[model samples]
Target: MNGDDELSLLSWMYGHDHDDPVPAPRLGQGYVELSGGPLDGSLLDVTSWTEDEIATGAVLMTVLGQTGPDGQARYAARPGDPGRWDWSGDAV
Candidate 1:
């Protein structure tokens, strides 16, 4: 009927019972961060992406300063940094 009880009920409804506190989510687990260029400091969700797909990298769209109206900017993942993607220049 109180906070803990309510949380437990919610957890049960979600199909998981956690006696221990759930650890905070980290980057690359459910999402990856974008670094450098136009898409700097952005987070891309990878929850549904396969390992191969992620490793091959992604072409993310952005409307940052470089990309004007109706424009598209693309970024790619750099080597040795799976947790982050770097800008690869603007797209047509």
Candidate 2:
């Protein structure tokens, strides 16, 4: 896909998880543009990200999926741990 198309895809992915409480870093506030696409370019797909946003995206993607890099779910609870049962195995 073209660059704009790719950026659009990234933006959509970034914005997909409405239930995730982890807020994406504010773009202009946390990062400055050196050179690239439109200043208002969407930071969703995977490409159009500031460094902080990319880190956030990685976390969001992992949480939305069942298992993360270590093969564990986004959240886990130890047996006998207080409030342990509240975690869903599949819920992002």
Candidate 3:
């Protein structure tokens, strides 16, 4: 992906609107980026009323979490008894 695409993805991840549609992802430039995800870039919606969804808000479905260092987990909301979130990156 190019720089612009990455920035757009970042904006989507941060769940904020940008005057330029796909705004740059700076800590305080105008967006609040969340930390964690599927890593596949599914672009989970951790916040409500995303700029793109302002017309039609969305409901939370799958969830993702990033723990210390390499620790990471995913809680997918799927059919019948979703699997528990597991993180193998935690150090003992």
Candidate 4:
């Protein structure tokens, strides 16, 4: 694999959860809209989203090790290396 591929895998295996809080905004049918601030506190402009979109994003993030407690996967930072990753919770 290329360097980018390796780095992508590494990030997937050792990425942190999205640090920003999800803003609880009013949403219309099939779409949630953010009035102020970036969506998910991200700098990018994310104007709208749907429940299915959110669920799919969460699932993908979990698979990529960027999930928090709410996500399906559980993770903890390594002792010495903050970037390293491992599962932290009860088995099964």
Task: List TM-score per model, in order.
Answer: 0.57, 0.18, 0.19, 0.25
**Per-residue alpha-carbon lDDT of model 3 for 2-33, expressed as tens digits?**
99457555544423343555444434332222
Task: Please write out the lDDT profile of model 2 over residues 1-92, one tens digit for every residue.
Answer: 79844544344223446675544434343221111111123233334555454433222223333444333222222244321212233323
- Runs of candidate 3 exceeding 4 Å displacement: 1-42, 45-66, 80-92
Give me candidate 3's TM-score against the actual structure: 0.19
Ranking by lDDT: 1, 3, 2, 4
* lDDT score for residue 56 of model 2: 30
* Superposition TM-score, candidate 4 onto the true structure: 0.25
Off by over 4 Å in 1: 1-29
Candidate 4 lDDT tens digits, 32-85:
111121122112112354534443332112332234443444333335543233
Pairs of colliding residues, candidate 4: none
Clashes of each: 0, 6, 0, 0
Full-model lDDT, candidate 1: 0.56
lDDT preference between candidates 2 and 4, better one: 2
Q: Evaluate model 2: give its TM-score.
A: 0.18
lDDT of all predictions: 0.56, 0.33, 0.35, 0.30
| Model 4 backbone overlap count | 0
Candidate 2: residue 6 Cα off by (Å): 6.8
